[model samples]
Structure formats: structure tokens, C-alpha cells
Target: MSTPLEANQVEAIQGYDAEKRYKYLVKEVVANREIWILTDEHGCVMLNTDYEDCVPVWPNKEFAESWATGEWEDCKAESISLNKWHSRWTHGLEDDELAVVIFPNQDEDGLVVYPDELDFELKQQARKQNQR
Candidate 1:
């Protein structure tokens, strides 16, 4: 487990570069047993196992907005950090589920991905459904 940061220390991170802040957030989520982050229908950050069960919990509006739009290239978001992006929305999670962070594509509307071994399969299914 990582050392818990005091409120002031956490506040200090606000001044950190996006890369540093992003890393710290991921570290916290992993240490807390891998809570996953997802986006709800309205593009707010959420937590839980399935997309349907997710509820908005994270607090960073700017980060959430960028992620909702997939404008992550400038954010230097790698797969791992991107998965942990939920931490950018808030400092804590509502539950512990596998430390994953899921993002919805602009085309996916109400759905999000879990990004595991089945990620490709899931994406294919989503595409097929969209083709309907």
C-alpha cells in the first residue's frame, strides 16, 4: 500500500503537471485494490463492475470532459493510465472492482469497455451492434 497523503499534500498535487497527477491517481487506485473508472450516460466519471451499474463519482470536470471526447493524445494517456483515468475524476472510489478504468467512445453512447483480454471481442460486438 502507498503512504496516505494528507489533505495539504494532496492539494499540492493540484499544481503537478498532468503526467505527474495522472500517475499519482493511478497509483492510488491500484493500491486501493484496483477500482475501475467508467463514464455514465451524461459523461460523468463513475465506478462499479458493469456499465449499467456505474454512477458518477469522480470530481474533475475538465478531465472528464476531455476523456468523454477521447481527446487524450495531448494528455499523454497510455493504456494503463487511461484505464486508471477515473482517479482523475475523484480521489476515491465507491467500490473496489479490479482497478480498471473504462472509457466510452464518442460513438458508443451509453456503453463502456472493461479493457481486459476480451476487449477486442467486446469492441467487435459493439461495432456489429452499431452496424444494425
Candidate 2:
């Protein structure tokens, strides 16, 4: 079951293309100061793609929870603060050569971005938010 707000959000972004979703993710994560990912007893979930392995991220828990079905049914939404993401996650993902899938939709479509590229965008978003 989803909250009314969550349902509204789902509806609102239903028509957003991948690029728009990616931009929404950057803005939301910066404003929220956290990023959401799915995790289970083992570890954070990773997606295997033809080109590279990707860590799927969302702007909020509700979005992350939307992906926690099927093979990821046991997964739980986890939050990583923006500071931790910058201090640790970006470097760790870069070392592992993992890309990031930003805010995938129900059809499993999202923008696949390199760790450095995403990190840069997140920082830029954060800076813009600070200037406001």
C-alpha cells in the first residue's frame, strides 16, 4: 500500500521521460540531503547491464520501495546521506567501476550514469540549492 502522497508522486512522474526523471532525482536528492537504494541481508542491490553493473538509486524511500518486488521482494529501502554519498559511495562505486541507474521507472528504464558524472551533478545541485 502507498500513501496518498506517494500515489500522487507516482502519478505525477508517470509520463516523465528518463532525462526528466534524472533531473528530478538530482533536484530531490539535493533538497532531501539523502539518496535511497534497496538493500537486503546481503548488501545493496546491483543491476547487471550489458555495458556495466549499476547501483540503482532513487530520490526517496517510496520510489526505492516501488522497485522492491519480484527478485528484490526481500529488499528494504535504505538511505544514504548526501555527505556519505559524496565522502564514500562515489569513490567506492568508482573503484568497483559501477555505474548508477537514476530513478528507474516501472519499466526499469533510467539514465545510466558514471559515478563521477553523477557525483558532479549531485554536487552542482547541492551548490545551487545552497545559493537559494
Against the true structure, whose lDDT is highest?
Answer: 2
Candidate 2 off by > 4 Å: 1-4
Give the Å error, residue 62, model 2.
0.6
Could you tell me how far off, in angstroms, the CA of residue 63 lies in candidate 1 after the best superposition? 12
Expressed as tens digits, the lDDT of each residue in 1-132 for candidate 1 is 234456675456445654454444434444442333334444334445544444321123233334444433333211223234334322232333323233332322222323232234333444555577
Clashing pairs in 2: none
- Per-residue accuracy of model 2 over 1-40 as CA lDDT, tens digit each: 1122467767687568889999988988888888989999
lDDT score, candidate 2 = 0.87
Error of 2 at 29 (Å): 0.4
Report each candidate's C-alpha RMSD, comma-separated, in the order given. Answer: 15.4, 2.7
